[model samples]
Target: MANKDVEIVKSSGKRVKFSFDKLRGSLKRAGADEKTINHILDIVRDELYQGISTKEIYNRAYALLKGKETFLASRYSLKKAIYNLGPTGFPFEKFIGAILKYSGYKVEIGKILNGLCVSHEVDVLAEKHSEFILVECKFHSEEGRNCNVKVPLYINSRYIDVKQKWNGINSNKPLTEGWVVTNTRFTVDAVKYGNCAGLHLLSWDYPKGNALKDRIDRVGLYPVTVSTLLSSEEKQFLLDRNIVLCRQLIEESFMLDHLGVSENRKQKIIHEINKLCNL
Candidate 1:
């Protein structure tokens, strides 16, 4: 048992004492059963050391799970997979569009809509029923990055501008809500301002049970980047072909064949993706 809190370094170079509760919570959230959780915890507890990085801890736990339960590892890597979608923010935008599209929203990505003051290229535009939502995706490659109040403040202005432009066109569906989604968490002040401005803010773990993580879990919409069987280049190749979601990958499984993937390897990959699709 880990009797004392272990100090660990984060990817952003911040140092903090690790909490077993946090690790346990993550495992539980990833759908690990109680027995598997305890087994992994026991093993990780034995290897605890001062100055171990969070990434190292995560890899240790992930490796343990991957050896036993493959899908659990993919689900556990949810946060990291979202991080892998970025560095350009375009794939992340496509990801958000896919999520919204699956949720019954008509989604358009990278649409250049003219605003009242100036033309703006919106990341995502979703129309469902009488509600049209403008979503701005904020993606960061580093861990522990926080989107601040300035982000919502800026996005709100952009949303209002676009809403005004559409309002003048006599469209049936009106822009109802503006959302700011990030792969990381938003600052307290950012959430505060968002709530005040009626902007729906989404993050990896924000909004309690209705976060981006929850939605992904609910919809079983794992990104192709979450595939453990596929290499980084393969994932990127799929992403470049706009096969961002696992559902899209299933539809475009021929892409794997085009990449010279063997039949047996393809079956393993399809099986892995099917497991995630059922998540």
Candidate 2:
């Protein structure tokens, strides 16, 4: 049985019915080319079965586009491809926002700043009691080797315009810190650049010898997981075993034993736990 729901409806008065052509039209409007559109449709048609929802159709299309190297041809294509991927990207921002919020900060997404002749869009802007934070969200397979340098470059190139427009306001006013969030781990050079630039960097994976706890402290963010949030017993078990670090969870052999759960059940349990806790 399919895990998702799909529905179909015939035309009603002025309302047109759903069709593959409609999907293609939508993709075209989003700036996808004919080849990309056809590729997306092929994936959907092959994977889709009866009763698939329109949203699921978009998700499959986005996933297919994400897998294509050509999708990275331009920023327009990147945005369209990401938009098609449903709300997965939002969670990356929201998770970081939650941590900031928990620490008594205000978080805003997609903040727009109009410069003298250009514009900039910041992913998540965080305002604490005394500091301002700018975050850029990137969901990639591997956090690029230049991920760290990239954040400062982006800030220097794009954010500088915003800053210049504001007429050199002091650091305490509108901008105080910068952050880059990625799915994969960061390279050592990237980490060093972040430290040098006074930027915070967060990723899904941690490097060797740098414990997750250590990385979280260095990045000024916490390592969060659905399992850690959902299961009180599991959380306590980890705490008792000194497994507060994500790297520890991944590297420490005793995690399963500490949780008193077998390896076979861990994956499913982790999935359900993440869903429940929103980690």
Candidate 3:
């Protein structure tokens, strides 16, 4: 347990206690064995400073976990790995598409749709049953960034234009919904606007326990970029070939061969993927 008096600083500039139980619980949830958890706890406890940043603590723990179990460390790196998709936002879009597909939704990405006023390029169009969702994927490379209100306001307007165009067709179409999904959190104003406008907002954590992270976890569709065992160059190799999920490796073991990894490393990657995907 953490000392009640020792305060740790968060990336958001908030001060909190260095809770060992919380850390242990998180590692446990990530599939760390008790032995590994105890080892990590002991190391972290000894290194705990008066005002250590949570990021530093997480880095320290991840390093240790990587040494103990590469796959579990990859699972622990999930949050940061999501942030690694950036600049072009292509990988993030593909990841979101994969999640929607896994959830039984037919998905289309980067489509230029004709709206009432003009042509708008939608990031993702997911259809399931009678519902159609036009998603605007707002990805941020930095942590603590937020999807602000203006984004939804703009997306809602574009959605209205597109829906009006559909009405002009005089044909039956699925009910269209607008969403602004991000890899980070949403601002208070953004939530307020989404509530007022009836827009769907998906962020890292919002709406209690049913956020994007929760949705992804529920489906067991984790991205390959989260694997600590894979080098950045190796990860890019998989990504370049449109391999997004680590689970994909199970089907195409030969893909690992292309990366020139050793047989032992390949077996470890396979083991991690199996454990993570619960297969």
Candidate 4:
């Protein structure tokens, strides 16, 4: 089969060409049914608008397939979609790492240490001044119910275990702080346990009370949105255009923009901004 060309505009406003043949080849290798592949392609073609990146097209296709009957089908579809897009997860890590570095912290990625060895790699380790922080990043469309408990357990097994080992080494170094950052909200019990254990948890939804933000600020690891991190010029452009591009960009990049921003809070902010701008 011949490659089908598509044009994508980058963030810098440069148009780059891509091909869909690789995606079709991947689907064929994955043994996807013809009907499904055609459906996905049709949806992508119908939905993708001007200036849409290949990554955006894939994300849209993934969201479309997620409504299907079989979980495996959805997973397969998403994997193919991501392949069509490009590298995503590590970019998110780097973005978050940059934020920490901006705030005067040393950031390390995929560091291996003498920890509990929880069977998975820790995303980022950050140190500032004299305090150590362990960050675990989860980049998923939606976090499951166990997402909260799982993070604490991983932190306890990894960071806490590493600290215990460190104590054995020096017995004087300070303990590392634990932080869990996810694309979805944390469970109520998870929040309660995290607070009690002095572990910092940041997620899509900030609990109703002031405590969550307070804890984040005090710990010097406040939740940051890509929107917040963007320069004033970018922010104004986003606001002026009412561009859903920010959300689309984050989704395509597999980044967490919804984290720490709840539906209610988002609505309120949009409302306030609209009122002030009289838009």
Q: For residues 113-195, what per-residue lDDT tens digits would candidate 4 score against the true structure?
A: 67544334667788876677778765553213235576676566676777766557744555568777654467777777777
TM-score, each model?
0.95, 0.41, 0.90, 0.42
lDDT of 1 by residue, 1-279 (tens): 353667899987998988888999999877789999999999988888999999999999999889977878999999999999878989999999999988899999999998999999999989898778899999998887799999999999999998899888847777888999999989999999999999999999889999999999887999888888999999999899889999888888899998999999999999988887783
TM-score, prediction 4: 0.42
- Candidate 1 is scored at a TM of 0.95
Runs off by more than 4 Å, candidate 2:
1-88, 141-148, 167-172, 205-279
> Model 2, range 1-279, lDDT digits (tens) per residue?
322343442221222234777777656644467898888877776676654555556556655544553212221122222222223565456545655565688888778977656978777888877667777776543212224456556655565566566545545576766677665556677778766766666665444435322333344333323232225556446545544333345446457666667766666544433322224
Please name the candidate that would achieve the greatest TM-score relative to the true structure. 1
lDDT of each: 0.90, 0.53, 0.83, 0.50
- The regions of model 1 sitting more than 4 angstroms off are none
Q: Any idea how many clashes model 4 has?
A: 3
- Which sections of candidate 3 miss by over 4 Å? 12-22, 33-39
TM-score-sorted candidate list, best first: 1, 3, 4, 2
Any residue pairs clashing in model 1, and if so which?
none
**Root-mean-square deviation (CA) per prediction:** 1.5, 16.3, 2.3, 16.7
Model 1: worst 10 consecutive residues (lDDT sum)? 1-10
Greater-lDDT candidate between 1 and 4: 1
Model 4 residue 50 CA deviation (Å) reads: 30
| Residue 220 local lDDT, model 3 | 68
